[model samples]
Target: MPTSASVRPALNHLQQLDGIRFIAVGMVLFDHWMVGRIELPLGALGVTIFFVLSGFLITRILLSSKDKLSNQPNGGIGKYLKTFYIRRTLRIFPIYYLTLFILYLVNEPPVRRTIGWLALYATNLYMARHVSWMGTVDHLWSLAVEEQVYLFFPLLLFFVPRRWVPLTAGLMIIGSVALRYVLYQARMPWFIGYVTMPACLDSFGLGAIMAFWWLYERERFGNVFSRTRWLWISIALFIIVTTLTKVLPAIPDSRGWAGHHNIMSDVWERLAASFIGFFLIGRAVIGFKGPMKWILENPVSQYMGRISYGLYLFHNFVFNVFHTQPTHFTVRAWRRLSEMMPFLNSSYFFQFSFYLALTVALATISWFLIEKPVNNLKDRFSY
Candidate 1:
């Protein structure tokens, strides 16, 4: 492994990461829009990618802050934590609460019923306990997981000595797998095993490990991840594990593996997905070459990635099939538009296109009107 002295200078921003976000969000949109029409777990894949990315980014930021604060004569740990929480809140809370409030006002039943959990970022825990989905807001479970991570991960990173961070992350990865196995043995529902915070830690842990390697072991990180074969191997591993859950016979009375009744899903599929996510993220960090670079760095990809949070937040509401009544204003408007245009309802492609366009438009508006302005506030609280 190469030392930090031989590593590339740390980047202030990586446009390629936004491109990676674009890919992740795109997978989610495709999975949701197509729904039962497709058999793949694209949404889960996308969310796992997000978890890895979040883990990597958040860990890196906290580590950087810790390093900076250690050297400053007047540095205070309190300020380190305060600034992190404030900036994170500014970026995440406003749009989320606004959307939730609007949904509550519109009397969306699921939101009305689960607003407390949703508001507190406990939707995943609630779902695990209840063994049910919350209609269009089911997607929020991932967001909730991330918010919960933000709540505690910084403290963990801040206090742990930098050299120990990778070991700590490795333990988390192992603990996640163990927790999933325990859930499976306890005869818990697959959803419980899948959505709970402990079971999802592997994704975050793997990401943290990647970030640690990049920061402190850059030569090895660059050399290992730069090989395209590793990326392909991870992808292959993910596919094989996922496919096995489908092909293997289900255990008696199992809630279904990966939502299919197979006993093979939650125990290892998530870990496999995390590995792929780790590699994808690693490649993005180390940088892509030729066409890959062009694809990820393109203006359209960058813009979409920039607005991905809005896209993820608004998309389900915009094109939801889980709810009978429209949860979003755009959905309601589209229903009325379809009534007049009629042709909009004639083809699946047209419906998808219309809904996607609405999602993008709404997200664009949100970027300009809500998110960007709120994000500017982050500058005042910078680390």
Candidate 2:
């Protein structure tokens, strides 16, 4: 068996990106379990971070591998696709399917009849129409969107001539924005277009465009984004705008898009978050050092980043299970302790502490027992 160092040598060294992963997944966890309790509006910005990061990293990898892929069997594209899918399958399918199988066996009520959607990566579609399924495997909607993006965007990048990649990415960005506008005006549920591939093309496209410019047209991109001021400005603007409106609020709450707000506000907010993500990627790729850099590269933060995938997958389920009033004997003991301590009773600090510790423990277990083992196979089909 390969050591952890051998399995992810390239990524393990990219400490900044790992830090960003923690930030992204951290937002999702906070928004789901802590936002209502704490009144912070993280919402979907975290998920958008993942989307943009995926676009940038995947495009960068594919472009980098073009030459090596061309030398492979059956004219490059076949081998490229086969290798890409295999690596993705190994990294993503094991934990994902295992989670679903357990959910099926445990028969989580909301999940009982809806395992098909989650298994098929259509959870977003199923939940958009049937709000009842919003709590079970519902967070998988983002995963569905990602899978759909990977399904087609990669083929476009692989087959298109190098010169036209930018144009293709641009059209996708425009198309996604237009789709969101149309849906908003038509009074469709925000959930409808929000989780679908077409409406999210802009986020992915922005990142892809940045990746193309950076890798293929590095001199030009570097010239424009060289100064650290631009990145700082982008970050400031993204935080201000995204927090103003809850684009994709917590599931089952269902109040984010119901009022008389201008729908275009939603589009602009998403675009803003995507732009911020693009600049952050630029900062990392350009090796800029600043406060954000220090925070991302911190030791504790990096450890959280390493297990972010498992944390994201398990957190919602864990939160739902424990964030309620005590029902069982062991849990009643925990509630009693909360009542005995003033700080714990009023602030619920102990409850939060306990839940966070348990979730991290579970994520650690999943990472070692499931994810790491499967991810070791990733490099076998490395791009």
Best by lDDT: 1
- Per-candidate TM-score against the hidden true structure: 0.92, 0.86
lDDT of the structure predicted as candidate 2:
0.73
State the C-alpha lDDT per candidate: 0.85, 0.73
The weakest ten consecutive residues by lDDT in model 2 span 1-10
Residue 350, model 2, lDDT:
66
What C-alpha lDDT does candidate 1 achieve relative to the native structure?
A: 0.85
Could you tell me the lDDT of residue 258 within candidate 1? 48
* Candidate 1 worst ten-residue window by lDDT: 2-11
lDDT of 2 at 67: 44
Tens digit of per-residue lDDT, candidate 2, span 1-383: 22323324322345688888898888887777774476544657788888999898777666655545555565488767877788888988888889888878976655677777788888887866664346646688888999988798768887787789888889988998888888766766666767877888888888888878776677877875677777778777876665555554422323444432345344656777788777876677666577777888889788899998888887776665433334633357566776776577666566766767777998899889989988998878765
As a TM-score, model 2 comes out at 0.86
